[model samples]
Target: MTAIGFVTRTTHGGFSGELNLLPICAHIDIVPNRDKSGDTSPDFRIFTQGVEVGSGRILSGESRGTDYVSLSLAAPGLGVRKLCANLGRTVGLNGDGSFFLIWNSVD
Candidate 1:
């Protein structure tokens, strides 16, 4: 049987900030909890290639009696100078979760 390995990362200092994540163009954020689900879906106002330039739910399941999930966004549409990406996520359910977003440029 193949064993699965888990990994967790922790960042510190000025290395963490919204600007560092989405420094240009897009306004990435978590779906506010106050807004009831099914009433409203996430809004990625910027659209490209006939696609919304965002990703769908990457995960969905229950953990520790709580629902765990995430969402993401793709790059290439933003027209950035470098080949980069923007990704966002929401954990738990009903938008009561936290967000992890990043705008990365790869050269």
Candidate 2:
């Protein structure tokens, strides 16, 4: 089981409720080896709030041997506040591994 939580937020007294993120969490399993058939690359998609925000090739030599994918989201322009983010990843072709996180606001 994979769990994530903010020890504390810098801005407010009660920050947990605003994010919809639990103190602990778990994601689906990912396949160990996706190269069984020696295909070029695996297909992967990432969604936030049930909306497809990002998609790309998984381990297709972009970073080399990176079993994990990452993303960073921030307000479009500087000096703008009130923001939240959710990141998700699917490791391999078998659809056995997945992970996600909901980030608290910076405001």
Candidate 3:
């Protein structure tokens, strides 16, 4: 896997940064904010392969006592299949201020 861009958490323990998708020419922008109940807002924007795909605020969910956030993004008409196929294995941020979207083969 290769790192495409980097991200940093804000003072409020939320993500507020920019990440470049590299070679693909896409970018991700994250904005951190809280609601009246102190819930972190998932305000994010996604650009797929250099074109603006989708944008929205995701709601947080819990599973097995663990809280997590999930997001789904895709370009108009083209759908997520293409984006997912292109992104590959996993797309995640590292605690070390780096992010990567890799395509891994399970051999």
Candidate 4:
């Protein structure tokens, strides 16, 4: 897992970060998706400025059973396939800054 972004916890319980998705990078805000009423609904919504770009769901870690955000990110700026990633504790940061937005690799 490669961390492509850094996010800090917001006062409103959301996250504010800068995402670098190679061809397209932007300052992003991760906020709760208030319309989550079903199992498949996204747990959180992602935005750049005011435009929605993606969403995420809470996922359990495979090795440790810990929780993390599974992101399904997409926009016209991005390619046809969605950019899937994970949000978790940074290795060196130790959750101090919540330095994350790990890119999940297909290989």
TM-score, structure 1 vs. true: 0.28
Predicted model with the maximum TM-score: 4
Q: Tell me the tens digit of each residue's lDDT in model 3 across 1-107.
A: 55433445446544333434433444454333233233343354444445545433444335555433233345545433533211212235355543333332222
TM-score of each: 0.28, 0.23, 0.35, 0.87
Clashes of 1: 1
Give model 2's TM-score versus the native structure.
0.23
Count of steric clashes across candidates, in order: 1, 4, 0, 0
Q: Is candidate 1 or candidate 3 better by lDDT?
A: 3
lDDT of each: 0.33, 0.31, 0.39, 0.84
Error of 3 at 25 (Å): 4.0
| Residue pairs with clashing backbones, model 3 | none
Judging by TM-score, tell me the better candidate of 2 and 4: 4
lDDT of 2 by residue, 2-104 (tens): 3232212113211121122333131211222224344544233333344333332333325565443322332233134433333344356324333343343
